[model samples]
Target: MSEVMGQQKNNLELNDNFEDHDSVSDSQVVDYLFAHPDFFVKHAHLFEELDIPHAHKGSVSLVELQSEQLRKKVRLLNYKLNQLISIARQNEQIYRVYADLNLRLLATQSMEEMQLVLEEVMQERLQLESVVIKPFIGAYAFPEIQRRLFVEKRFRRDKFFFGRLSEHERKLLFPQQEANSVALLLLGELGELGMLAVSSKDPSHFNPDMDTLLITQLQQFLSILLPKLMKY
Candidate 1:
């Protein structure tokens, strides 16, 4: 009986030791790999032997799984690269169109010719819904009260206003045309010359946060040109 009891105690202690040794956690394994980073480099054959559970396929070799993950990352990078390229090409085209319009504007002899040139480029080339130039004190001037209100409200701080306009403002600026979104440029040094309203069908097309580099150049050129044209 003593011999049997001693044997049983020895068996229990061996089992307990085995359980403790087998209790290696996933975190401990990860820490071990992180410490010995070159372990995989030394035992490269493990890449073939190790199985990584896959969502689509039942399981894949470590090398194959890593290759797939890399391919997905490359595809995502390519998609973003293509989007940037497309935007750059669009910006270049816009710059060319504005450059051509500037040249045409420089050659205009009268205000009528200037207005026609603006309408032609903005409507036809830029594909804007409408374009209207309203001089402060002239035959085709915006209503005095309306002009003052717009200057006070829209051009209170900035020389440019973008995004949606009130119904009254829309009607005054674009008479019969639909203007979901509008870009209102205050002409002259202190916005005394006129207002140049450019509209688009797309509601989100003209936002205040949009880059004004091209339109700013146009505004400066118009400010200098309008005074000379108004004299005629």
Candidate 2:
């Protein structure tokens, strides 16, 4: 139902004939949202888990979730055979971006390349229209949670108070000048972070009314994938 999710469904839908292919259905996504509101709500513990959804819960484990619930959610998110194909296609895009940037990164040898990879991830993985990943001004050298405050503050300000502030409020709080850009942070080998943010020349992209699920999924994606990708 969220734009990103909608695009995800659309991207997956573009794959092939639905007559035989099992596919992701919009109804299933809606059903989960209606049934499992708390299950989908964002939590910090998610950041600690690394097992990919379909992979066996290996030694590098994620929190044991309600297995059936997770299965349904994954199934719903993934849809059917064609959707799985779409998911594969999407990953290929991610790898291509990663491969190209990895080569560039090796030559450039700049830590900033990681963030650049994130910029590419936004386009490739998440499929947003425009993206900019400004490093947190003091975040680089700060302690782990210190940088988090900015994200938290931004979320809380948008959430607890407004609960759904209009688009105007988002711009004032997360403006480019503050360097409060939403980015997927990489500590490399240690872990990664995913951020949800929008942009606008029209000024409505950050509007308070926007759905928070966008942010929630970024964190969720990191929760499931970051630790698994870490080197042993």
Candidate that would win on lDDT? 1
Give the alpha-carbon lDDT of every model.
Answer: 0.92, 0.45
TM-score of each: 0.88, 0.28
lDDT of 2 by residue, 66-146 (tens): 565689888887777778899789767756754564354344323355446656655555554335332332333434464
Scanning candidate 1 in windows of ten residues, the lowest lDDT window is: 134-143
Q: What digit string (tens of lDDT, one per residue) describes model 1 on residues 71-117?
A: 99999999999999999999999999999999999999998899899
Model 2 steric clash total: 7
Clashing residue pairs in candidate 2 (N, C-alpha, C atoms within 3 angstroms): 22-80, 23-80, 24-79, 165-208, 166-208, 167-207, 167-208
Question: Residue 180 CA error for candidate 2 (Å)?
Answer: 15
Q: Give candidates' CA RMSD values in order.
A: 5.2, 27.9
lDDT of 1: 0.92
